[model samples]
Target: MTVSDEDLAIVAEQLGRAPRGVRAVAARCPSGHPAVVRTSPRLEDGTPFPTLYYLTCSRLNSYVSRLEGAGLMKEMTDRLATDEQLAERYRFAHESYLAERDAIEPLGTTVTAGGMPDRVKCLHVHVAHSLAAGPGVNPFGDEALEQLAQWWPSGECASKVKN
Candidate 1:
């Protein structure tokens, strides 16, 4: 779970800057590179950071952006409104995210990233949470991950990056 120097290098390459409040490697790509990072609820400077799971792989980020641009968020939002079971599950995901973040340090905000419970604002956050928490935690996130193509053609993203 620890974020190693190699992981940091790859994350830096992914974000194009040094990441802050990164506590652990949340999830890895199929190629075994750091894909999602778990960040602290509060930053070093005492700023509240609600995003607990951060997506760090650029390729995956691009793919998720493409999905977002294609109106996937609207489609998911519509489904969430009509599908009671799906909505319930998504609510649980939001609660789980809040619980985890509160455990780290309470942000005192009900807003979980990616617009959980009511809408789908960002596929990137949902996918990161799904990848980090594993399947069945976030239905929308699980769907996003299912739709994503294998981004790491060159194997581990850390090894592929030039630091």
Candidate 2:
């Protein structure tokens, strides 16, 4: 099997959630593709359970792992540092980046203060808004951020932010 397919198999073996498919009723649209869609593990009446509970749970974990290493925090924080305070800036940047405050609850009703995708998503929002000052935009330095981006996942994880 392909690398991602093999990895997905491993995740399936581990999470064991509900059937992992993206359909209209199941998801927002079966034929239509929805970005960043997450299915709940509940029945129609919200009383029963799903076939596989691993689907959503495993996907969530994968998202976190991928995003965490993407240097989302480091990259954003890089804009706000001086040559001397690069290290300290990035440290602060990483901490705030991982400190998400817009996470949805398990029930998908309320937003959590420090929920999953909070750090990554929130941090990205801050970056998009350009909320920091120039040369001192982020707390991290350019070199440190470059190192992080090189070392971490270089996929869309560090790109998108669902503000």
Candidate 3:
């Protein structure tokens, strides 16, 4: 999908700056605002940006941050150490992310964002990946998304964007 001017404006409002190397709108809010953006594996400056799915919705970001502050990452990490099936799925998610990124341009790195397969470091990245790739791709991301409040209750977050 093409990134429209409105999508750019919404992402700028969410990130406080213009986004670079945005490939497509990965996901949108209920009100049709850009919530997650699929970014290029390599940036315009030739920098290897491993983060393929980027969350651009401030409301969702704030909510996910709150979940992180609540020590959810620790709980999830502990579970990963014990749950074999969950760990396997998480590893698949990591592999999937790596494959997608490599398809764009090989970064020669195994470091997938959000600390996949081993630990949960950043909920924002996990949640973004989950939202972008859809359900069943990232377990941690699905869990984080489940914990978020109704961030778009009033409508799309873009409606709340200020000039």
The best candidate by lDDT is 1
Clashing residue pairs found in predicted model 3: none
For 61-104, candidate 1 gives per-residue lDDT tens digits of: 88889999999999999998799999999999999999999999
lDDT of 3 at 64: 85
lDDT for 158 (candidate 2)? 19
lDDT of model 2, residue 92 = 52
The 10-residue segment with the lowest total lDDT in model 3: 149-158
Superior candidate under lDDT, 1 versus 2:
1
Q: Deviation in angstroms for 107 in model 1?
A: 1.2
- The C-alpha local distance difference test score for the whole of candidate 2 amounts to 0.31
For residues 53-162, write the lDDT of model 3, one tens digit per residue: 99988778888888889999999999998999999999999999999889988989898888876898888899989988888999999888766745533455666454
lDDT, model 3, position 15: 91
- Give per-model CA RMSD: 1.9, 13.1, 2.0
- How much lDDT does candidate 3 score? 0.86
